[model samples]
Target: MTKRSFDQFFKNPRHWREDLVAVGGDFSVDRLLYAYTHGIFPWSEDPIRWYCLDPRAIFDIHRVHFSKTVLRKVRQKKFRISFNEAFPIVMQACSYREKDNTWITPGFIDGYLELHKKGWAHSVEVWNAENVLVGGVYGVAIGKFFAGESMFSFESDAGKIGLFHLFAKLKESNFELFDTQQLNHVTWQLGAYEIPKLSYLDRLERAIKDMVPWVIPLSHD
Candidate 1:
């Protein structure tokens, strides 16, 4: 679909708020869930205008590209990948890595924390040999849908490692889709694509229908 057409569909907010409660106030859990299911989400910093974009970017698990460089890094196993071990830390790192204020406001973080407690949000962490939290990614996982939020890295290729490992495991676990929300050059290089907003909503609906419990093991090698 053309970019203009994709941008048009996300313009409506008739049913955005549950009962006319302004969405820009805070990132409530209910609103987060509604936004995800409807192909809209909170992002921008202005609370008064809370941003949601169109032509959403996503990756089909089977389509993720692993380059030779990434493959070599994975094979070397220089860092360890663990799931849910340092969720809050990962989120904080992603937020603060640039040394700037972030879109994942305190409200968003708290809301996601609740989602994690309920098994909806998940985090994949990367640790160096010293077991230091070098990089990671976190997002909401509803059934076959994994809505990637953000990632950060302190060491070279650390973020990529987390991403590749996450995709690899999700594929092994039979995940159907990985939604990156909006694609950038980096994500596009990693095989994410933009789809018609309506198509995205349809896929999201189908995915969330058969909710799969993401079982994260407690130990790692």
Candidate 2:
């Protein structure tokens, strides 16, 4: 992929038309990191028409909705949660969910795996009482921001439980924002709200400067 200026290539995500900075390039580790750091993420319907998205809406860390219904399910704790235990498998499963549009192609998977190995990507995994992997969430974490990419569940409420735990852990770790790329029904129900690009960028700028310890280390191969 050709090198693009992240600042120039990125603007708050818009859906009325294609709002992309650059397209048609390789998925290199460097490109991916720069994109996420600057609030840009890739999306393509056909795998060939890749576009970077930095949506206008974001999940305010303090405003995340935990509905009584969802909270009740979360409290039931039908599953156990772990971190980084099965990152690859969790990511692959998240890539292919029935009837969902996927940007997590093989190349994207390889790119994120590289990010994981570098400690820039991480997973929150949920397992059943039988010790079977059931649900999980994954995203890119840089500074105090954890940009939620996707999630999946093999059983009822597994993903929701995983999300609840993920938020709990993020709070403990002092993360500033939980960025969900665009406004959707799922996040709407979860309490994410849309903010204008100007405000989002301001918060994003401050978020990138928080020097809290990353949830994982970047030392190994």
Candidate 3:
């Protein structure tokens, strides 16, 4: 299968929720990886229509905030976090519709599962005391960077546990950056801020050159 070239996304990466570059392109694993490596991603509100976004706002590792509430929850140890253990399950869970709608369509799941199989994508799962999976965050990882896709929680603060562990582990492993893609109310609360596209691309260029394997240290508990 021939994947679409990244050049087709746009000539410039600096923009704020402007417009779709191209729609209806195949979401091939190669294509998806290429998009992420180039700081572009596919977002579809209706699933039938996909837009490629290159956001100015991104999450820096130093800026990923933990509020007092989130900090307290992380301290509670209510969930056990694991990585790449149950990606298919977590992907399905992230795609599950808690609200009236969802963008994680069948197409999206199949494409990402392929990426996961190739080790270009990964997930961090949070399990409950009973060993049931409660929350997870899945994203594409190229080299030293992780671009977060979606996170879902079955319990309060479950998703935060997964995220906290992900950030902690990445920092320990010498990872360079985590791209949350767009800045919104949700991402803002998580400490994502806007940078010029030139600034981000410079960092991304270096990040994608270094390899930092996804690893989660075993909990002594």
Candidate 4:
């Protein structure tokens, strides 16, 4: 499929009125990278709609919050954390929500798996005492910017544990942007807040140009 630039589809000023931006594109690795670096992302996959939200949501790497209960779980070492250990499994887990429909289609998985193999995507995995997977989060990274895509937990507080570690990794690596895409209850608890789209795009432009490596430690608990 031929790829088109963001300006091509976002010419209508009305497109800025809502978060939808543009619809119908392939989920190729290059397309994904281009979209994300430009403050755009694919939230759905049937026809593959791309979005750059008006009020973009993000977490300040240095200002993440952990509830007292989550802090206790962290202090107790309730789960083992690993980086890039099980990217496919983590994505699959995030896609399986019994109570709601998911936007993560098979094509989306394939596209991101390719990105993982190319070192542009990464995952933080949580494992129980027996080493079975319990929770995880996955996202794409470009330069100093990281776009967190989704997370899932099978055990209480497990997903939060994964997010805590992910934030730590980003902070440690001097990442400048941590885009959660949109705010939800979980993200709100983690200290995510919104910035106007123009502000977000400005930050994104600088972030994607500053060279930074994803040198997170292999594992943590």
lDDT of 3 by residue, 43-101 (tens): 76343344434435677776688778878877887777788999888888888885666
Off by over 4 Å in 4: 1-18, 211-213, 218-221
Displacement of the residue 168 alpha carbon in candidate 1, Å: 1.6
lDDT of 3: 0.75
TM-score of each: 0.82, 0.83, 0.84, 0.91
Question: What's the CA error at residue 37 for candidate 3, in Å?
Answer: 1.4
Deviation (Å) of 21 in candidate 4: 2.6
Which candidate achieves the best lDDT against the true structure?
4
Q: Pairing residues by index, what is the TM-score of model 4?
A: 0.91
Best by TM-score: 4
Which portions of model 2 miss their true places by more than 4 Å? 1-18, 45-55, 210-213, 216-221
lDDT per residue for candidate 4 within 53-145, as digits (tens), equals 888899999999999999999889878888899999999999998889799879889999998988899999999999999999999988999
Candidate 3, residue 77: how far the Cα is off, in Å: 2.0
lDDT values for all models? 0.74, 0.73, 0.75, 0.85
State the lDDT of candidate 1 residue by residue for 1-221, as single tens digits. 33443334344433343312233544556556655655566765355233334566889888788778878988998898888888888888888835568787776777788878778788999999999989899988877788899989898878889988788777766777678877788899989998866577677888888765577534445
- Give the candidates in order of TM-score, highest first: 4, 3, 2, 1
The residue ranges of model 1 lying beyond 4 angstroms of the native Cα positions read 1-22, 45-52, 217-221
Clashing pairs for predicted structure model 1, backbone only: none
